[model samples]
Target: MLFSTIVATSRAVGTTRSRRTKVEELRSLLAVLEPVEVEPAVSWLAGEPRQGRIGVGWRTLAGARVDPADAPSLTVSDVDRAFTELAGLAGTGSTGRRRELLATLLGAATTAEQEFLVRLLTGDLRQGALEGVMTDAVAATAGLPAETVRRAFMLSGQLSVTAAAALTGGADALTAFRLEVGRPIRPMLASPAPSLADAYSRFGGDVSVEYKLDGARIQVHRHDETVRVFTRTLREITGSVPELVDLVAALPCTSVVLDGETLALDPAGRPRPFQETMSRFGAESAHDLLLHPYFFDCLHLDGVDLLDAPLAERLDALQRVAPEHRIPGVLQPDDAAAKAQFEAALAAGHEGVVVKDLTAPYAAGRRGRAWQKVKPEHTLDLVVLGAEWGYGRRTGYLSNLHLGARDPDGGEPIMVGKTFKGLTDALLQWQTEEFPRHERSRDAHAVYLRPELVVEIELDGVQVSPRYPGGVALRFARVVRYRPDKTAAEADTIDAVRALLPATDSG
Candidate 1:
């Protein structure tokens, strides 16, 4: 298929706010794609390339200027092949080689195609066509149930792969997707609760209150001698975390998939700062700060898949496979007992507790109310829209951060408020060095970003405001930390921010 078709469809999807219209447009596009072009086209529409990051950035793209072709002649395969070559470039002259290759690819495209390719390469493509919408489109085109496509995607952890299967082989191919012991599936997510009382009221006594640890999320898959560890985003990190691999390898079960948290612990067995734990994730080896794994949920054990099993049964399997490493929690606890567990988790240097419904099956990659996380203080993972230059001793650094909440309706992030509090000198320096890479536009007071970075912000509450488009502003907002594990799409939504409004002033 021609690349221009994709550019036109993306533009059509972006210009409309109706999700049904977006899905219909994507369905029309998917229904006509050639079999060989399915995966790459789907990946591009999802804002991720099939080749992953090709070492291209905004600076490199800016320098690769070339005259555009008058007509659309480039095929989807053409861009894929060029990106493959670019991703393989290395050594001293690789930078120049990448620029040359990108220029060659862009020079053969028209203006519209050039815009799409640049956005795709630089990770700045923010149209309404998200993975969920594309999944719905795929299901619609294939004449299969939406849940089937979603299940396959959750198990495969790649929408591109699942979409290809659905488009090519229909229902039978999607059914072929299963909980493979070696392949890492998407991790289940939890929604935030107002308080412990609210969680108890929702689930009654049929809930398991588990400690919500302050650490990086890890998913370990062990099949016999081989053990692979993946981060929450399903990126493999087996080599960086040997301790995690070895720990899972020693489990009595021959094959298992464990979902849990891993963090560095001080001498007193208390969890270290989140940054210290995350720093080890990018290292070649488990540096001096060795991470310890704590297993909480079991997705697979032996030969049986527990993904469809209730939390009660999954916990039983987790106990059977790695009882010693299970997280601290109480099953079916009374209100007083659940409260005590929540306090105990906080006292033990953990974040808080997640109250999970005992009867609900594991909903991978879906953040639902079946599991609700309760913390003592209100915290939100918000997008960094822009940052202002610092003053006083912090001069020359990006200080005040303009925060935004993710739009649930697939639009631009909604601006909530700004803050300069809780930023240490080290954080300020890091912001100055890092924020420019995501720059969209700039002015004398601030450098606006592409709404890509997710930062955890703590706020007392929110109040009605006309200063921002969201009609709400964060109260006493301050930076808790930058959540490298999360994507901008996974940040707390505008509805969540509005849910924090004062009771009498909810208007």
Candidate 2:
């Protein structure tokens, strides 16, 4: 099938917020596509040349040059080959050439198709139907149930693999599948709850609540002495975390798969500031820094897969095989108890705790009610320095706002961060109208506002950074509300800001 056909269906899918419409459009497109065309179509959608896990990609020039009469039968292997060639080209050539190549391939598509193709390629497809929706699509197209496709995905760790399996082997193939090592399965994620009470009411009294440390989520797979560590996204980083390898290799079990968080800890045993941990993780220095691996869940022990096991069972296995120091458990069931634990955690310089359900299995890649996290809100009084134009639904509004913090010695406020979050339509309109009144200068895209307005900004935590003028950046920062009563001069100072830094162990 022509790229244009795929593009058109993708565009139709992108234009609507409805999952049913998107699935229908994708199915219609899939009907006309030869199995061979699936790779290019998906490649064009995902934006990357197919990589190791996904099918292979082909050179656009070579692929487009193929005569329609001689076009080979499209198979999963062909897709894999194409992606391998694309990956090689991407590694050696200029970024512009790669982008140009991608654009040329996409240009072979229709305008509507081009829109969806671009959205997919750029990872900006916001239809709210991600993997789950894709699973539904695969199931619908293959005459299988969504659960069959989901199970296949859980085992194989690749959507396209599951899709192909369902299309070729049917539902029975999926149900009988088993997991293999060296292949990464998707990590499970937790959904949010409004409050602790709501979470408790759902799970009842027997649910487990574990301390949710602020750290990077990791999955460690060990077979005898060999160990591999992967991030939540399944990207391997075994070499970067040598200490973790030592710790995992030392575990009692001969073969195991464990889920946990890796945190940099100070001498006091408190978690280091997130910025410090990130910097340490990114450092090129061979010198080792102290890291704590807090094992919370076990998926595989010995040669047995525990993915189907209950959380309580997994916890028991985790305790049995993993080291005592690595296991993380602190029970807090009630609001008062949870709040007290939260305070103690903060006082001890640790991030808040994660409350989990003891009965839920590891729902790989699915963000369900299995786990819930609670962290103390970090709010700051910051001055608005400038505003930038918004896009799409937010077009014509002052959406991006530059924020700054007061200098300790009292001079110009240092630029700390920028945020487009927490704005209502009314607030946007007010800012658009009122900001120009305080305009100091103008660029082609943005208006520089006077550092006069002080707004209360909330964030997850502060990270030290070389990019910001303040030498720090806020993580997950958003607006709480405007602080109309506080002037910019009355904003918090650098010294006051430094005090909020996590305590560092000199040892």
In terms of lDDT, the best-performing candidate is: 1
Q: How close is candidate 2 to the true structure, as a TM-score?
A: 0.67
- Per-residue lDDT of model 1, residues 119-213, tens digit only: 88888885322777888899999999999999999998888899999999999999999899878888788888989999988987899999999
Tens digit per residue, CA lDDT, model 2, 241-345: 888889888888899888888878888788876545555455544346767788888899999889989888888888899757454455435766666665676
RMSD, model 1, all Cα superposed? 1.9
Overlapping backbone residue pairs in candidate 1 total 0
Off by over 4 Å in 2: 52-83, 90-129, 280-287, 331-340, 378-443, 446-507
Give the Å error, residue 507, model 1: 6.6
In order, candidate lDDTs are 0.90, 0.66
Q: Which ten residues in a row have the lowest lDDT in candidate 1?
A: 123-132
